[model samples]
Target chain A: MSARNHEQWTSPPKLAEGEWVDSRIYSDQTIFEEENEKIFKHAWIPVCHESELKDAYDFRTMTIANEPVIVVRGKDMQVRAFLNVCPHRGNMIERRPSGSFKEGTPSGTPKRMTCMFHAWQFDMKGKCVYISRQEEGYQDRLCTADVGLRELKCEVYFGGFVWVCLDDDIGMTVEDWAAGALDCLAPSLNEEPLEVFHYHKAIIPCNFKLWHDTNCEFYHDFLHYHNRITGFNDAYFARKNSGFKNGHINVGSFEVQYDNYEGFHSREELSFPHLPPNHWYMIDMFPGVNFNLRGSALRCDLMTPLGPDKVMIEFRGLGLASDTPAERQTRIDHHNSIWGPFGRNLHEDLLAVTAQGSCMHPSAEKRNILQGRHENETIHDENGMRHYYHEWGRWLNRSPSNPDEEFDEALIAAASAKPAEVQANA
Target chain B: MAEKHASTIEQIKDVIYKSCLYQDDLEWNSWLDMCSDDYHYAIRAFSPEIRADMEYMGGGLEYMKSLTQMLPKHNTDNSPLKRHCTVYKVEVADDGKSASATSSFVVYQTMLDGINSHVDAGESRLFLVGRYNDKFEISNEGVKFSDREVRLDTRRLDKGSHWPI
Candidate 1:
C-alpha cells in the first residue's frame, strides 16, 4: 500500500447563475429556522391517512418540526388534529404514536382524551370536557366552555390522507393546496379503496429538504444499479413531470419492465384498475408529503424535520381494502420487495442523502444542483427538482439559485398568469 | 417427555441444525434442497410502536425462488454470515405426520473489509437476534422443511443486510 501519497483538498466549483446552490441553505441555523417557521409551520402536511385511524377514537401522535401533533378520530367519525399540548400546564395529552382513548367510555365506542398531568381532560372532538376541581380554582371563570385544545386547520382528500396546517389561515385547503396535481392522480388514487398496510419510519441523518430532494430528483436513477438495469428503457424516458401551482408535482406514470431485471419476478397481476399494467406514478406535494403508486400497491412518504442535520421520514404502504388475504399478501410482497424498509431502490436513496450530508457537513461547501436537461421534459431530466426549488424560493422568499436576492417579479407574474397545464411542469 | 421424543426428536433436531449450517455456510443451493417443493420461509418481527407483528422479509415458494435467484445482485455487506441456533423445543403433530419446532438463533456477520475488516478478520459482529419457527414434514422419503419463519427481537437494522439473516 502506498502511504506516501496524499490527495489534494478540492473545493466545490462555483457554477454560473441558475445552475447551482450554496450548500449553506442546508445546515445554516438561520435558514433552518426560517424553514421551520415559514415553511413547515405554514405548509399543509398530510400527516396520516383515514385508514390508519379507521376505528373511532383512534389517534396518531407525531411531531411536526418541533410541535407535537395529535391526529385523532372523534366518536362522530371526524378526523382532527390538535397541538397535543395540554392547555392547563402544557403537558402532552396523547403520548403514544397510535392508540385509542379508552378513558371516560363505558361502552368503549368513544371516549374523551384525558391527560395524566393534573387530570385535565378533553373529548375526542378536542373540546374541553372536564378539569379536576374546575370550580375551586377559577369559580366558573375558566370552565370547559372557556378552554379547549388548540386546533389546527385540517382537510381530507379523496386520496384518504388527513392534511393539517399549523398556520391559522392556511390560505387554501388541501384540495386547493395540491391545485390540479391531485386531480391528475385522482384517476388511480380514488378508484381503489386503498388502506395503509405497512408503516415504517427511519431517521435519516440529513436535512428534511435534503431528504425530500431525493424524491423529486429523478436523475439519481443512475445510482440504483437495479433500477438502472430495469427502469431506464424508452418507457421510463417518456415520463412527463407535471408541475402545479403551490409546489405540487405529479410525474406521469409509465409502463415499467419489472421482468427486465435479471433476478426479480415481473409484476403481472392486480394492478390498480385506473393504471396501465406494470405502470407507476408519483405525486410530491410541496414541502412534506410524497406518494407513488404501482401494481396493487400505493406508498405515501412523509417527512418531518428533527434538526438542521436530522430528518425523520415515514413510509406508509397502502393496498385495496377489498383485497383478499392472498391478494394482500401479494401486495405486501410487491411493496416490500421494492419500497419496504429494506427495499433495494429506497435504501440506496437513503444512503445517498446521508452521504451528501456527511460530505457537506456544516454546509461549508457549495454544491450545484444541475438542472440542465431539456430533452422533451422527460424523467431523465431535472424538471421536477427545478420546479420544486422555484416553489421553495417563493415560499422562503429567496431564490434557490441566488439565495441572497428575491426571485424576479416577472417570473412570479408569468407563473401566476399562466394556468397550470400538464406542460407547466417544466 | 424428552424420552418420549426418542429418535424422532433427534432426527428433527438434526434437520434443524443442518438447515442452520447450510445457510451459515452460504450454501444457497444446498439449503434449498433441504426444503420441500412447497417450502415457505419468512423473516418476521414484532413492532411495539404499532402494536403489531411486522414482516421484514418473506413470501411464497415462488417468491423464495425469485429471492434465491436475486441473491447475487443484492448489495449486501462484503462479509460472511454465521448463525448459532439452540433447538429449544419440538411438538409433533397428533397425527405423527408433522412437527412444529422453535429454536433461538443469533446470527453474527464477520467484516472482511473496511478499516477493521483485515486486522479483525474472523471477529464476528452481532447481526441479528431472533428465533426460528419451523414446520417439518416427516415421511418415509425424508424430513423436509415445509416452513421457517425467523421472528426477530430487534428493529433498528442500520443500513440492513440485503441477504436474509
Candidate 2:
C-alpha cells in the first residue's frame, strides 16, 4: 500500500475527456481488490457452454473472479452451481476440470460431488445428502440442509453459453447486454450455428483488461505479424466505430475486405453476407468478457482476473457447424492462423501487455485513465473505463468525480440522501 | 441415416489423395469442386492440457468459396506453398458409403539466396504427426469429402500453420 505515495492515490488528474488513459490502473492493487468484490463478483461471467454439459451429473469446475465454483447437471435435468469449496473441511469438491457424477449409490455406484477431504456427499443440488458420521457421537448436531454447498446464480444465454454472476442482481440481462452487438453477431451464430472447435487457453502476465482493451481498439492492426498475410494495410478498412448498449460496448466494426482469397470472392463487393462485412465488431461486456466479431469468424474472449495485474485469457474460435470437413478446415486454418494462442495477432497483444506490466513501476496509482475518443461517440466511450469505474464507484462507494468522498463517506452520504428523496416523493 | 456409397472403398482413397495433391498444387478450384455440395471441413487441435474439449474449424461451401477468394489476395510473406504429403491407414466404413483415412505429412520451405547465395530460410519441417480422419461419399464423377477432422497427435503447434497440414 505504501509503494504508491498518497498524492499518487489521491489527487491524480482525471483522464482528458477523450484522450490518453493514465496507465496506472493496471498497477494498482487496491483497485484490483475492489474490482474482484464489486465487478467480477456482481457481473454475470460466462463460464461454459451448455453443450459442454450435455449429460446428467456432468460437472465442470471453474473459478469466477477468483472464487471456485462448480456447475453440474442434476438428475432432474437442471444445470446448477455450487461453490467448489467443500463445506466440511474447505477442500475442493470437484477435483477434475470437467466430468460427470452418479445420482445415487446403487452399491457399486459412486456418489455425486463426493468431497475427498471428509467424504461428505452432496447431491446435484449441492445438498449434503450423505454423511459418514451420521450415527456417531455427532448424531445430534447434523444440520444437513443448512450445510449444503453454497450455490451461486447461474443463467443460460440465448446461444447456450452458461454465465454465472456472483451477485444475484447487478446489471442488465445478458440478452439486453448483448442486443446491439448480437444484431450484428447473430448471423454468424445463426448462419452456421457455430460450435467451439478449438479451446485455446493462455496464461498471460497482465491485467485481463489490458489484453481485452487492446482487442477492443484496432489501432494496432499493423503490428500483427499476420497482417502482412491479411492485407489489412488499406487505411479505409482500418476505420473504427464504437457503440454502447446498457453498460456494454460494441467497438471497431469498420469495414475490411473479406472475399478475396484465391478461390473465394475476388473483390470486397462479396464481403457483406446479410451482415456487415469487413467490419470488426468488439463487444466489451461490463467487466471481463469481450466477444469479437471479425468478418471472417467470431472470436470469444473470456478473461478471468488473477489479480488486478494478471489474467487468464481463453480464446474460443467458432465456424459454421454444418460445413464440410474441407470447408471447416479452411475456416479453422484461417481462424487459428490469426487469433489462436500461438496466432500472430493475439501474440503481439500478449507481448505488449507483458511489456506494459514491467514498465509499470511500484509508484503508479492510476486507474487506467481511459479518456480516449470520448467525444466522438455520444455515450462517451472514452469514458468506457470510466463507465466501468462509474459502475465500481456506485458499487464500492468510490468516485473519480469526488476523490475526497472516501468509500465510507460516499456510502453514508448516498444512504442518507436516499431517505430524503423517498420523503419528498411521499 | 447412413447413406451407402455407390463406389468401391478403394476408389474413394484415390479421390482423397487427389484432393490433397490438388491443395498442395494450389488447385483451389478443382479442390473446391471435389467436396460434396453439403461438405463439412474442420482442422482441429485437441490438447491434453484441457480434457473434454476439442477445438475445431468449420465452414460450408459458400463460406469456403468466399475464403478461397480471400486467401490469395491477402498479402503474406510466406507464399506459394511447396510440400509433400503421405496418406496412410485407410479404413472403409461397414456400409461402404463413407471411409476414414489417416496420413503423416512434413512441409519444408525454401527461401531465396542471401548475400553469398546462401539460403535465407530453407528448412524441411515436421509440420504434423497426425491422422486425417475423413468421412467420404463417392459419386460416379469422383470422391467427395463429407467431413474431415485432422487430429494432431502432438499437442503444440509450431508458431502457426499458414497452410492446412
Candidate 3:
C-alpha cells in the first residue's frame, strides 16, 4: 500500500546472470491489465495467414482484444484489414469467418456484407454502399462518404503471414521485427502456400499471460511427463535476444543437437517423417503470439486474454503450398502429432500452465522466475523479460527501475548510427 | 473406384470392431498386419463451421507403428484407457467390396489414484461418431483396407492417445 511498495512493483528486478523470475507476473491482476493495454493493444498482432485470402474479395473476420476486425483482399488483390463492426450501429458486418464476395455485389443478395441488425450494408472496401433507412432516419446528416469501416495497418510477411498493428506509433515494421528469424521460418514453408490442416481454439480457465509465460520458459520441459517417453534433447537450445523496432522480441532457439539419449527409443530411430534432424526455432511476439517453425512444417500459436483469468489460444498448422495431397496430409499429421491442442506435448503445456495459475493466487505474492541458467548461457537471461518489460514500461508511461533501460535509445542510435547498413538493406 | 472396393455392411462393422479391439488388446503387431504395405490410416476432424476443409491429426501406417511403440513412455499418470465401441449402423456398397460403418463409443479412462475417473462418450452426431469409411481390396489374400478415413465428431481433443480408436 505504501508508495515504496508501488514503486517496487513497477520496477522489474535488475538483469543478472542466473537471476530468478517472480511467478507473480503470471497471477497478478494489475500486471495483467497493464499488459493487455500496453502490449496487446499496441503491438503488432498476427491476424491470419495470407494464403487464407489469396484472391480479391476473400475475407476473414476476427476479434482483437474483443474489437471485431475484418481481413480482406481488396480490388487490386491487396490484403487489408478493418474494424469488423459497422460504423452506423456497431453491429458486426461480416458474418462468417472467411469467404469471397464479388467485387461489386448488391447488398443483401449474397456476397455483399449486410448487417442483420439494421440492414446496413458495406462494400468490399468497407464503404457504406447501401442503407435501408437512408432518408427515413436523417436526410442530409447521413454521410455515406464518412461511413467507411475503420481500417487497420496490415502488412504481409515473407511466408504469407499477415500482422496488423492498431498503434499508429508502431516503431518497427514487419521486416525489422522479424530480423533473421524469418530466414529460419521461410524454409519451413518448403515453397508451399501455408494451409491450415487442423485449427483449434481452446478457452482455458487461466490468465492469458500465465499461458504465454509457460511457453516462454525452457525449464518446464522436465515437468512434462511425456518428455520421459518421447525422449528429450539434453542439448539445450541456445536462446538469443533480438527485437523489432516496434518492440517485438525474437527469442530464437539455436539448432538442437541431440545425442543418443535413451528415452523414447532413439531420436534417430523414430524421427518425424520428412523433417531435418537438427533444426528448430520459435519467434515470440511482444504481447501473446509465438510463430514456431518446427522442421519442415510451421506452427503458429496466438494467445489472447479474454478476461483476468480466461485466455483463448489458437493453434494453426501450416504446410507447403506445392505439396502433394498426400504429402500435405503427412505434414499436417506430423504437425498435429507434436503441437496440436490434443497432441501429447501441447496437452502437457496446458496442464503445466494451469497448475502454475493454481499456485499463483493473489494471497501468494512473492514469486520467482527460475531463469537460473549458468553464466555463459545466461547472456540473455533477463533480457527477454527486460526487453518485454522495457516496452511495457515505455507504453505504460512508467519508468523502469533498471538503470540500464536503454533499449529505446539504443534502437534510435542503431538506426542513425548504421546509415550504411540501413541503406544497404533498404 | 473406392466405392467399388468397400466391404459388405456386416464385414465393415466387424472390421471397425476388430480395429478397436486390436488397439484395446495391445495387439500392435496384429494391427499392423491388418493393413497392407500400401495401407494408409488418417484421424481427421472437420469443422462444419469452417468450410469443407478437413484437418488430419495423424496419418500413415508406419507413423502409427512408431506411435504404438512410443505410447508406453508417455502414458499419463491417470489410469490407462479402456475403450468400449458399439456399432449402430453399417451401409454396405452394392458390390459388397466395401462399406461405411458408424459406431458409438464410450471411452472410460480409469485413474491410477482409484478415486477419480473420466469418461468420453458420444453418439453419431453425424460429425463426431468416428466412422470407418473403409475401402476394401478383397482378393485371395483375404480382406485388407485400401483406404480408411476415421472421421471424429468431437472438435476438441483433451488428450490424444497413440492407440487407434
lDDT of 1 by residue, B1-165 (tens): 457656777899999898778887777777788788888888877654455566767865666666667756654445678899999999887666788899999988786641234455677789779999999888888688899998988565544555565
Task: Write the candidate numbers in order of decreasing DockQ.
Answer: 1, 3, 2
- Candidate 1 per-residue lDDT over residues A248-293, each given as its tens digit: 7888877777787654666758787677788888888888688888
- Which number leads on DockQ? 1
Q: What ranking emerges by lDDT with the best candidate at the front? A: 1, 3, 2
Best model number under TM-score: 1
Error of 2 at A107 (Å): 13
Docking class of 3: incorrect
Share of reference contacts kept by candidate 1: 0.16
- Enumerate the candidates' DockQ scores in order: 0.33, 0.09, 0.19
Across A137-222, the per-residue lDDT of candidate 3 in tens digits comes to 87888767868778888898766777887776777887766555455555555354566555767666577766655555545667
Clashing pairs in 1: A243-A425
What TM-score, computed on C-alpha atoms, does each candidate reach? 0.86, 0.64, 0.75
Weakest 10 consecutive residues, lDDT, candidate 2 chain B? Answer: B111-120
Q: What is the lDDT of residue B17 in candidate 2?
A: 72
Counting clashing residue pairs in each candidate, in order, gives: 1, 41, 20
